[model samples]
Structure formats: structure tokens, C-alpha cells
Target chain A: MKLFTKYNRINLSVMAVVFVLSGIAYYLLISNLFIHELDESLNDYKDKLHVFIKQHNELPRFEFFEDIVVTYEPVNVALKKKFVLVSRFNAEEQKESTYRQLTFTEKIGDTYYAFNIAKPVEGTKTLTKTIAATTLVLLLAIVSGSVVLNRIILKKLWKPFYTTLEELGHFKLSRGYVPVFATAGIEEFSFLNRTLSGVMREANNDYRILKEFTENAAHELQTPLAIIRSKLDLVIQEEGLTDSQGLALKSAYTSINRLAKLNQSLLLLTKIENRQFAAVQAIDLEAALKEKLVQFEDFWNAKGITVTADLTATALKANTELVDILLNNMLANAALHTQQGGSVMIRLCPGMLRISNTAVSGSLDNTRLFHRFYKKAAHSQSNGLGLSIIKQICDVQGIGITYRFESGFHHFDLQWPV
Target chain B: MKLLIIEDEKDLSDSIRQYLALEQYTCEVAYEFESALDKICLNEYACIILDITLPNGSGLEILKELKRQGKEDGVLIVSARNSPDDKIVGLNLGADDYLSKPFHLPELGARVAAIIRRKSFSGQNQIVIDHLTLDIRDKTLKNNEEAVPLTRKEYELLLYFVSNKNRVVTKEAIVTHLWGDDVDMADNYDFIYSHIKNLRRKLAEAGCPEYIKAVYGMGYKFSIPS
Candidate 1:
């Protein structure tokens, strides 16, 4: 069975805690029995030795009694003092024995080189080693069991959350806003997913409504504009238009032209807002850019600006018309902002294209690049939405755009993946 | 022929009526659908110039009513909606033709005149002088119990010829009538010459007396001895 990844990072930490708890419990139970048995057996051995010693009328020596001591030492700490209990009889009729735990006490006078008992603690090392080994085994089992539990039980317990996540992964806003996630019984998760789905639905609903409004407004405005233009045509064709009258007619004509242009720009903005460029196909960017540049050459020449172009054979998967609009807006902005003799230089590399121009330095604000309906206070001749259009195009086409004032040039480098 | 134009804009409808009247077509106007509908129910008109989108209700509804009443009255639907789907729908609902907004008044008059002729008589539905017959609905020329084939465009040129029969039709008028917008694209009038030649040959080979006559540097005419 495969294990869950999320629980693994924490399992070691949680299991370390659980493992320590289980190890301490097991250690307490096993080591207490071990030490109790040692103490009891030692006492019993002492009692037996007492009986034998009294019958023979001899006592144990302090140095030799070390062999019978209870051996208990935690592996974590060293044995500070190693000792055994020894007893002595003052008189034959005395009932109380003088006993002391002695590690270094030596006998003052020993007659006949006699000691009645051999109380040796030499085997305590092996006993302590065995207890330590048992505690170690208990600790290993606790850790392994904790790891197994995290894999088997915790992973299975989080299965519903994973299933919910998989369902959420399949949800997308474009196809439809409806989410198919069934309510999991987990309240926190249910609340979280439901709230997320609700927020998504609201956002999608707002987007759809705005999109519908934009389209409807654009469509509905066309008829009135046609009416106005047709009416204006009649006035222009009327009889007796003299010189000053002709100038007034020209003014009216310019006004109509600007109005029509404004209407077209609004419609274009609405289209871009509605994601009309989403269903783009692979377009030859080189040919498309050349066509745009060629179409604008006459206009730019009339404006007394020179266009230095270097187009290459390159392609990009994007909406052709949007890219066309982007190039037009950028070039038009350059033409408007540059001096009469200024040059707009365009270059293309393997996967990047750069358009650099000499502009009125420090005039364009870098911050108002993408703000809609923002106009510069000083440069009121042209709309300030040129850079915003470029930014939108970049966002939609997945292209990278950077605007910088580098080396006295207004440089815009548009990069796309190959 | 009298035509009633229903449009909300007074100045546009006035200008259209004035232009068509100058073209010698008797025309009237209704600024709203209700008045248009009342006039339509009360009077006989050769054609109705209807706007698809109206203030009170769609002009399509009036066209629908006229259609339901089995009125063979011709209709030309005009609208600002320039999409192809709108044209198809309007035509599907029995509009004889459609014009997008901002159209030339002369163009509108031409279309109205053509639709009226087509509604009144099925394609050149006239015969002249005993030996020649024009069966426009069948797109055939008969010289007593025999028929002949005409190329797709030869038939169109012949119809143009017969419609303006017995009088000279100008080359400019023929281009405007036959080619309409396509005349601007052609380098010369050689294609018109070819179509006229094909029509003449087919009609003559059918043992039909030659009725198509051409004037030098002018246009063609379909004639028979009065």
C-alpha cells in the first residue's frame, strides 16, 4: 500500500511523541518489575545467607558483599556508586543486626581470614545489560507502530479530504460555474469547500453579468451612432456651403470622426474585457506584425516619424486581431509622444521582440500604466490608455512585458515562450 | 408604385421618402409601428420598407401579420444590425430583401423597385410580337414548343434586357442593375460582353428571332416590331 505524503512529515514528529509515551509506559512496567525482582531476590539471598552465617557463626565482609548487590542502572546515566548491604552481630543474644550499605568500608580486624558469605555483584552488569536491551526493544516497537499507524489509519481517515480535493481539482470556471463537490461529513472541510465553491460561483456570476452588459452596451450603441452619422451626412450634402461654412463643416466632420473613434475604442475595450481573445489559434506573428506595420507606414510618415523595423519569421499562438490592436496602440503612442524627427526602432530575436523609442523623458508616469480611463494632466492630446492596452494584451497572450527608462530610451521588451 | 417606410427617426424617413419621390416612386412614411400597422391594414401599398428593430415592437411582427394574411405585398427589412444571422432571420421570415444601416438612399430605391417588379410579375413575365416569348419564372425562352439552355449569367443578362425592353438601357444603368457592387471590382466590361453574346447565341439557336439589340458605346435592348 502506498502512503500519504502529508502525514509523513508530521508522523515522525507525532510518532516521536507517541513513541516516547509508549516507551515510557512500557519501560515503567518492565523496569519496575526487573528492579523489584532484583531487590526481592537480593533480600531473599541475604536472608538465606543470614541463616547460613548464623548457623556457622560468621559475617560477611564489606568488600566481598559487593557481589550480591542489586544491579540497576539506566543506560542514560552512569552508576555513581556501586554498593551492597552488609550485617554484623554485636552479641549472641542481641536480636537487632547492625547493617549498612557499604561500598568502600574496610574491615578493621579479620581473624582466621574468614568470611561466611560470598556476596558478589559481578553478574549485575549482565542483568543491567539485559534490562537495557528490553527497554530498547520496547522503544523500537513503539516507534515502528506509530509509523505504521500514521500510514494505515491516519491516511485512511483523510481519504474523504483527498477525494474532495480531487473533485475540486476537476472544477473550472469556463465550462460552467457549477461545482459538483458533495458535502463531506467533516464539518471543517465541508465548510471550507462549500465556502470556496460559493465564492467562485459569486465571482463567476459577476463576471458573466459584466460580460453581458458590455456586449449589450456595445451593440445597442451602434444604432444611435448610425442615426447620428446619417443625419450628419445630410447636413454635409446640403446646398450653399461657402468657405467659412465649409470650415464649420470640417469641424463637424472632425468631431464625428473623433466620436466614432471613441465609440470604436469603447467597443474594443468591452470586447477585450469579455475574453473574446481566449479562443486563439496559432498565428504567424511575423506576417501579422508586418501587415500592421505596413498599414501604419503612411500614417507615421505623415506624422514625420521614421519607423525602423526588423521583423523575423516567428509565430505565436494568440488572437491575431488583438495582437494587431496591441501593435497599433504601441506604435501610435510612440508616434504621438516622439518628436517629429524621433525614431521608433523595432527588433526581433529568437524568442523576444523589443520596441525602443525616444520619448519626452519623464513625461509618462510608470504607475498609471494599466489604469482604465486615466489621462495625463500634461499630455492631454492622446489617450493615456496605450500602455494599458499593451499590458492587457500581454496578460491575455501569456507574454512577458517590461517597461523601463533605460539609457534615455523608453524601452518595451515583449517576450513570449518558444 | 407606392411604398410606406416605417422608421422611428423622422429625418431619415423624410430623406428616404424625398429621394424615392424624386425617383418617381410614390412613397409615404410612418414614424411608429402602430401607425404603420394601421396604414398597412387600411391601405394598399406596392411595398413596405420596415425596420427590424422598432420602439414599440419589432417590425418583424408586422411582416409576420402581413405574411399570415396572405398579402403578396413585398417587404424590404432594414436594420442597424449588420450581422449575417440577422439578415438570414429577416429573409427567413418573408422579407424580400435586407439592407444594413447607413445605406445609400439610391440603393434603397433600387432594391425597392426591383422587389416590387418581382412581386408584381414573376421574372420577365411578358411576351412580345407573335414569335418571341419570355417565361421568366421558368427562366426559358420559347419560340413555339422548343426550349434552349442559357448559362447561369446569360439568363440574368437576358432578363435585364427584357425588363428594359424596347428602349436603350445605359451601360452605367446595366452595371448598376446587373453587377451592383461587383462592377467596381472588374477591370473592364468584357464579362458583360461575354454574357450578352452567350444569351444572343442561345436565343437565336432556339429558332427564336433575335430580340436583344445593342447600341454602340451604350447598353443593350430587347425589342420587337410594335
Candidate 2:
């Protein structure tokens, strides 16, 4: 749930409870004041009656006034003076009405008489009801007003926070970009922005340093490797070398070559990760594949591996060098792994390419296939970086690649971006 | 022919000098940028083997200076920085060719030879070895005044052999030279042997003397049987 909605729910509920309790308390207080005033008038009326009886020295005539009713009863014993509330049927309105009654006993010329004075409370009750209805209407108006106001104001307040979240969602370490967060006026939001900026800056710095280290390490090894290779090339030319000695030299040469290729491959992977090849161009997929196949024709022919190609005209927009490496690695992988006298099939459509070669072994470990230095055969001469290079190229180019085993063939499917 | 070697690494420069010495080329060594600049300003050479990274300055500066001087010397850039940008920049700055470091020595020798041939001969380039003649321009082979048909790879292999004649060339070098280093056919020595066998048969059928010799487990050597 949104923060605004949650806050509004809690705020409005608490406001409603307070408003309702206050409204009931207010009605009770107002109605009690009205009843106290009516009781005061009733006592005043009794005092007036007593005064008149004393002044005249006889029973005064009973008269009805406003909503007050006065009555007298001669009793053998005097009754105590008190106030009582009673419900009585009214002849004028024909309905039950509440009244406040005052009763007392008085002796006039040796005869004790009981006097009762009562007043209807219908007006006070009606006033309290009207007040309560008005309070309820006011409470609803305040609650709805606060809800709308909080939604608009809180949305504006959290604008910077949401913007920061969106920017972080698109952050990429390989791009080496550190976003500059806008300064938020709110204290907590500003603090959050400052902290995130620092973290992103540090991450980008660390990434750049690591990439530079990889590139430098690869480059530094090249000169020595070249020197060793050249020295070996000259050493093997010496006359009168024994067969065993020549073989040892050849093995050392092969290892050095492998080392060189491994170093170069690592460097290339780093470059691709860094997005160093940024130049993009339109490439004719059919022409490029056909050209690469012709280059590999001699190798396939020597191994007696037949190739079949079903191609359509397809074009892709990507870095030229990366595309070339991608194609080279894919084709080389197919040729190297296919058994002698086996067949390799290539099919290309508008946005997909599939290459399937006769399986030399069972299905490979799909999870570890594209990992660096993942070799299917333990003693294979390949540096085991071909598939990794192909994978890296596809990832950087936004192409989808998958491997599968079917019909005794290892199939690699590539989905091109539209 | 004279060539200049501008490289910071002394061991590599010495090895290059030793290998090229067998080809009867006089090589001058410059271990730093100042000496390289001084040498280029003072003399003319058939080619200059330049390294991109030097002690005092970049070898690209030397290439730019050479172009500014308008000298006809061929330049072959050999750098360990295999980045495509460096290669493009070097070639764009008028360097004749760019060869990344850790390259096979025979490949280096071939590139240098091709640059020198292109610069000196001005398109009329040919290599005549006894009864065999190679037309570099047309990429054809002639055995005793009769044209011998050669496939593209076979012709390139022959040219590479003739460039570093009498020197043992590893099968690894030949494979990388023909199919490039990216092909990863290191275990396919049989393929190399077969291709060499075909070239030998074709040359032998043309009544040429046997020139290519397999050097006991090391590699192959193409030389006049002496």
C-alpha cells in the first residue's frame, strides 16, 4: 500500500473516533444545562406559590402556564420536598412527553397540602438532537477534506524519493555512470540522496580500477610472451638437435602459445564487459556467415566434416568487431567439437540463427557451458574460452543464446534483437 | 636491405635481429624513442619494425614523424596492445601494417617482407627461388616458365615459406598464418601436414627440385637442398 493511503487511513480513523466522542460529550453537557435551568424555574414557581398562600391566608387558584402544570392535594400527612422526572401522556399533543416535577408539602391554616409543579422537556431534547446532527455533518466534512489534502501534499513531498528510486533502477555498473541525485528539501530525503550518491561513486570507481587492472595485466604479459616465443623460434633452428630435445621445445612452444591465447581471451572479455567496442553498424548476416564458412572450409574438409547451410537475408545492428568475434567463435566451436565424418547444420531466419553439430559426447552441462574456462573434454587443446566469448558478445549485444541437445546433435540457438 | 627495430624490450629486439639476420637483412636497433627518432632522421631503411609502447614516447609518434618526413620506408607496427583502436590508429597514421605482439616470428617476417616488397617494387613484386617463381601481385606460382595452379591458402603458405626461406617454421605458425590465430586448430597438425603435402606434390609434378623439408619433430623448412 502507498504511504499516503496508509497515513490517511490511520489519520481519518483516529479523527473519527475523537470527533464522535466529543460530539456525544457536547450533547450531554448542553442538555444537562437546559435541564438545570428548567429545574431552577420550577423551584422559583414553588417559592412564588408559597408567598401567595402566606399573603392571601387561603388556597390560591391553580393556573396552567407555558408548559408548566401546577396541582395541589390535601393529605393527612405532609410529604417531603423533592424533584422527580416522569413520563406522562399529554392531552394536547396526544403523545408521551418527559417532564421534570417538583413536589413539596405546606401547612395553611392547620391543613397540610401537597403541591406538585411539572414542566415538559421536549424543547431541550430537540435542541440537543439538532446540535448532534450538525456535529456529525462537520466531522464528515473535516475527515474528507483532510484525506484529499494529505494525498496531494504527501505526493508532492515524496516526489524526489520516487525519482531517486527510478534512477537507481536503471543504474548499470558496466556503463560507469554515477547519477547526480537532485537535492531534496526534506531532511531525511536529502540524507538518503547523499548516501546513495557516495555509494554509486565508490562502486563506479572500484569497477574502473578493476577493469584497468585486468587490461594492464594482460598487456604487461604480452611483451614477455612475445620475447619467449621469438627466442624459441630461433632456438628450434639450431642444427644437430636430438629428436627428444626438439619435441620438448615443441611442447614448450605450444604451451606458450596457449598462454598467449588465454591472456588475449581474458583481455577481450574485459573489453567487451567495459563496452569498449561502441561503434555500431548494419551487418548483413547472410553475407558474414557465408564468408566465415568459406574461411573454415579447409579445416572442415580436412576433418571430413560436412557442412550444410540454409540461410536467408538477415541484417543486424551491432559493433562490427564484436560481431566478427561472435561469428568466429561460434563457427570455430562447431568445427572443433564435431567428430570426423560428422555433419554440421546452420539455419538462419529473419531474427534467429541455429547451428547444430554432431555430438562428440553427451549433452554438456547447460549451467556451466558458458562459464569461463569450462571445458567439456579434460585434455582438449582448446583454451576453453570460445563459448564464453560467444556468450559475452551476445550479452553485450542484447542477443539471446541457448544450447540444447536433440537428435544426436548439439544445437546452439541465437535470437537476434529486433 | 636495411631495417630499423624500435622496441623497448632488449631481449625481443635481439631475437628479432637474430631471426632476420638469416634472411641477409641488416638490422639496426634503437632501444628508446630518441634513438629511434635520430636513426630515422639520419638514414633510410627498407623497413622499420616499430613497437607502439616505448620508454620515452609512443612508437606512434615515430610513425607520425616518418610520415611527416615523406620518406618511402615501409613500417610494420608490432605492439603488445592488441586493442582494435591502436591498430586502426596505427594504420590510419600511414603505417604499412599492424601486427599484434606475441605473434609468430614467421608471421612477423612475412608482414615485414610484404611491406618492403610493396614499398620498393611498386606493384611489380616477384620472388624467384631457383626453378620456382612467385608473383606476389597476381598471387600465382610459376615453375620453370609454366604456371602451376595453387589454391589461395597454398599460395599464401608458399609465400610465407619463401619470405623466411631456409628457416624452420613451426606448424603452429603456418596454421595461424593461413587461417588466423582465432581459428583454434592447435591440435590439427594433420591438416597442416596434408596441406604441405599437397603443395609439395604440385611443385614436384612441375619438375621443380624438392625444396620443402620436414625438420624432425620441430616443423618444416623450405630451402634449396644444399
Predicted model with the maximum TM-score: 2
> A1-418, model 1: which lDDT tens digit per residue?
3455655656666766765576557556665565556556555655654465567655444442354432221243222322344555423325434233322211223432212332322234455566567656766786678678877887776776787778778776544556667666778878877887788788778877876776677567666665655454444444445667656655564455344445555555655665665668887777777876765554456555688889888877788767867777776666666666778888876578888888666645668766766665544544455666678778768899887777667888889998
Q: What lDDT does candidate 1 reach at residue A384? A: 50
Question: Tens digit of lDDT per residue, candidate 2, span A1-418?
Answer: 9888789889988998998888888888888887899889998988888898899878777754456787788898999999888888776788998888999998898899998888887676678778778878988899888877887888899999999999999899888998878888999999999999899999999999998898899989999999999999999889999889888998899899899989989889998997889999999999999999998887888889999999999998899889988988988889889988999999999889999999987999999999988998789889888899899999889899999999799999999866
Clash pairs of candidate 2? none
Each model's DockQ?
Answer: 0.07, 0.66
Candidate 2 global TM-score: 0.86
**Model 2 chain A worst lDDT run, 10 consecutive residues:** A59-68
- Which portions of model 2 show Cα errors greater than 4 Å? A34-65, A69-92, A97-120, A123-136, A273-275, A298-308, A334-345, A354-418, B123-125, B183-194, B201-210, B215-218
Which pairs clash (backbone N, Cα, C closer than 3 Å) in model 1?
A: A66-A121, A67-A119, A67-A120, A67-A121, A68-A119, A68-A120
Please report the candidate that would top DockQ against the real structure. 2
Clashes of 1: 6
Runs in model 1 with CA error above 4 Å? A1-11, A17-179, A182-185, A227-260, A272-290, A314-327, A348-355, A362-368, A374-405, A410-418, B1-6, B9-52, B55-226
